[model samples]
Target: MVSTAPFEEQAFGRYRLLERLGEGGMAEVFRAKSFGVEGFEKIVAIKRILPRLARYRDFVAMFVREAKVLVRLSHANVVQVFDLGRVEGKGDEPPAYFMAMEYIAGLDLATMLTRCQQVGVRPPPGLATYVAAEVAKGLDHAHRRRGEGGQPMGLVHRDVSPQNILLSWEGEVKVTDFGIAKARDSFEVNSEDSRVKLLRGKYAYMSPEQARGRDVGQDTDLYSLGVVLYEILSGANPFRAPQPLETMRRVCQADAPPLERLVPGLDPGLVAVVRQAMAPLPSGRFVDAAAMHEALLPHLSARHGRFGPSDLADFLRRLSEQLATNRVPVSEKTPIAAPSHLTHDVDHDRTDVDLPDRDDEMAQASRLLVLGRDLLLQGDLPRAGDALGRVLVMAERHGASAQASQARMYLGYLDALAGLPGGEALLRDGLAEAAAQGHRAGARQGRFLLGRLLENIGLPRAALVEYEACRRLAITDDDPLLATECDEALARLA
Candidate 1:
């Protein structure tokens, strides 16, 4: 596919952006190559904040803060951040803030789950537990991290979703994305007036305390890690509701269906571990991530007899091959060529063909939505508003109700930020449409945003109602993050 092709070798400091690897709401990642004297070349993943965000002082501060935090976190199970600085933009473009990190030649836990679902294969029980255990170890390190003077850093990784956990072909599991992490000694502490809202993590994976916008500690990270473990074993998040409010409700109630019921023949002991880790109240959970890791070790030993890193490596490699062979071919129009210095590993190459496959109108709408989201994150309100408007028009014309709802939600967010009219109505309509379509995740997001907007507009009573609804939904969906956010909003009202 033409999208895969390296249009040109673009230099950013010593690193050359060889190919676009992926894009997210806040940043774009590239497969970059850094060269040194005597033919020393290293491949790194370069995450650059979008142009719009890079120009914002608040966003720039957050990016720099993330780098500072990562620099202090040294652990085998945590992805290392190698370098951080600004790369001068081309022509009239602004300087781009970038971070060079260790590149794992493998898929994230989320993609691995999708692969397992597509192949109708449950990952080996031992492997699943092992991966989760490794993640817990990483969390333990972060939770107990100390500062230069031996003072407790009190670091809590607010975001611990599947996308942040990477599993390499060599069987290394690393936890990443401390961008929203909270630590006492960190350069930036999250405040109510922060550019980004108080709620920081993925809604589905947040702990109850986090969801409520309450102060989080090590236990919060444990709860999220438990959610990750549960999904790894069952291939579904326990508290994934159709609406943010519902998800919050589920998280508050800790009302996940029994694991054995979801995955038949799952070990009872394993289920117990998950239940304890996911307990709504912090006191009911594991003492720390270390304790959770200890709990899982025996289970791993019992299920798959003598399995180790090599076993995981072999399984991942085989799975990668199988997935590649069965993957849908991308259009020939978007050809991608890897940099000569980079090795063509199966795990890396497999992610090269993630382009959308749809009709022209749908594809165009999707592109517009992404552009709108990126622009919004970067604080380009007017341009983002226009792009989102186009998305809504295209989606409505194409009868893509879900896409239309999403566009409406983005526009609503923009309006809310801009203190414009129709924000509440647009958000409500979007949430209702998402719920009608069984897009619980989307609905959940909409509700959360709406609740925040209402609060910002001094509608405490209305905001409380929305937050309460979100808390209930979060509990039903077993989402601690949403639940905690609701709790926090409700607390503020109190």
Candidate 2:
């Protein structure tokens, strides 16, 4: 809330601390600018360890670990750390350690949730799914990261909550405060050499094992994320009790009420995804974050096609504008803050971003369909099936009927070519559906595939009729390439 940083506009280890953003028990964050030669300056958030704790060996080790791990991570959904250094404090003061990080000009998920609760509305499911899925994408990247010698890094955030998730006004979802996972050989993240019971993450978000102070794995983070999602969608954390111990006990023993029981008419698909992520046993959850991401993305596939409601970016922008209009008087005490669920993180906390609206996911499906079609035509059955199968599932999920039919048409052709059963039936039914839907290209391809199947069955006259139909459709569509394929087939039959 300070109008200006006390050490305003002056250099401190290649950076000028402009203003404080937030502070917690261990460190303070400042909105600073990094100055370079030739008039270069870039705004960065500098996380400076509190002078009192800078000399503590274990705390310093933890701080160094946070910086090291953050520097290694590069993701759109994860905050970036660029530099770590030390600077002289005021005369007779201890040296200050700091880590410079990416400055986000938007609010944290905690703030968003609070505001939404104030307004008595939940974030749209599209936005919720988008957040969960994007965060999962970042987690998946970190989960798969390998060390220099190709060993699995085994990095886990150990904290995934609304506070740790930042949504920029431009629609970026960034997770903050990584590097919490202990080294690969260590079984517990929060455990030190003697296995002290110092708290590491919020109890409401803790996985069952983590709450019990036992070994945790990557699935632990997924469980925490599921808790966040549950709270966002249901407006309550089922495990949160007045007492921390009670909360931990509930996390270990109580089953979460089904999403439908809490919020009726929720997408059953998404409900299942969230429930699986929060399963008490890690084995019951998704095998990895990648699987969770795949299951969640289908929910967002239909977002781009919807109208009337603004997206998450717009919601944040409007919220920012409203908060600014009501800003109360303040001064000198603000510190750079972390997203609550994951502390020691940084955020922008202001400004607006107008990200371009995402195009409907069907566009992606369309491209995959075309690629699958080309691969099928080239006799690459395995690759073609892989691509076509994905496109079919995606198209079907998003209600892209034409695309789904075309996917079916191509897959049926692949199946027949590979001598699989039910090929002819699939091709004929898909062709009928595509033709009824007025999918000209799908109909054309379906005719050619059926003609080939008929030829393989020695039905020369039926195959001739199929080839002739395909040739007419291709010519009418001015698809010379497809017409050429039909001609080659007809010539072979004759």
Candidate 3:
């Protein structure tokens, strides 16, 4: 597939551009075929320095340094930089400074997340961990790579945001774009600019020190990557605000909202790993990305076990109930009236009748959902389907809004996964109800699932719309791979 945007055919020496891949803070990447020896045609990425930043001495210095640093990195997970030069197009003015390198045929983490949101799916825990492990292996390699004088490179990827991480379609996590990489031997801070407030890297993923533009070390990268890991596991950002300044302030001071608060019944072990990795103090967090991965190892291993439909359903049910309960107005929960016989009767009906009854239904529905989850988790598809089937009946009979919505959603999920009859219609109807109830989260999830369904049906454009909605409701940057895939899908359509 090719992009519709116009691009030069050739840039720099020995590289004929094919299409524009993407643009970043420092460079614009393009897909190009290397004009290597005969019988050896290779697809490489050609990254040209952005014209706007060319005049900045420090920025240009960083670009040149990045090219040199990249040559030293020989890891499989790091995109290889092959050649660098300046090139002038036919009749074009000043030459463009560009680097030709290996081209990864996969979407970056950002696109993956968008795709996942479109499809209403999060990668399984084991897969997410496996991806993380790959990234860690790459980072570890770069960090440990020896420089001139046989000294430790001590390379820190100060900007480890999802956009900089590529989760290839072939199931590999490759870290890319190291323009701001901090290598112990190569970088020197400019004292004159020390007082300048320059918020480097993506604000959303910045560590406290990075946000504050203070001297940062490997721990800063680790903390940033921890935020990435947190997003992948919990599907929510640890710290977020409406504006960049506010978000930076939160990164500097606020505690991350608990994982259970976003997705209840998530493995507590996973939450602990994420929380520990994202600790406010550098000392409180993992010493490195490898340590962060180690913290999540146990949970990742456990996730390998089968997940039945019932277990998934139960998880969603419990999660939904928790979310709904959190929505109850504080005033509504306050004591309504003085204790009189008439007030007592009304109170009894409201509290005991309505609230407890709702609670009972939620509990019952949650149990049934759990049963379904266990069955699904265990890979008992038929039994899981049967379990969810029962919840569907109960939800319809008892009029449990949260449970009913959940049950419908699960039933739709199982049917789609099972390739059962009328699954699309079922999912569509459930999504409508979820939307009508103003369950934005539920609606977001539903749209994601629906978008995936649409994609399966060859409706990529519709799927993109669904993913866009999903992103609006995304609580965290977790599942970027899914979003990236959605973008890839859209790209295909484009």
lDDT: which candidate is best?
1
Give me the runs in candidate 3 sitting further than 4 Å from their true place.
1-8, 89-92, 179-200, 303-494
Query: What lDDT score goes with residue 219 in model 3?
Result: 74
- Candidate 1 lDDT: 0.74
Model 1, 350-409: lDDT tens digits are 434443245645654654565565466456777677667766876776688888898888
Task: Report the Cα lDDT for residue 482, model 3.
Answer: 41
Compared with the true structure, all predictions reach lDDT values of 0.74, 0.73, 0.62
RMSD of each: 12.6, 23.1, 18.4
Q: How are the candidates ranked when ordered by TM-score, highest leading?
A: 1, 2, 3
Per-candidate TM-score against the hidden true structure? 0.63, 0.60, 0.59
Candidate number achieving the greatest TM-score relative to the actual structure: 1
Q: Which ten-residue region of model 3 has the weakest summed lDDT?
A: 330-339
Residue pairs whose backbone atoms clash in candidate 2: 21-335, 21-336, 22-335, 22-336, 22-337, 23-335, 163-339, 163-340
Tell how far residue 412 is off in model 3, in angstroms.
Answer: 26
* RMSD over all Cα atoms, model 3: 18.4
- Give the CA lDDT, 0 to 100, for residue 322 in model 3: 34
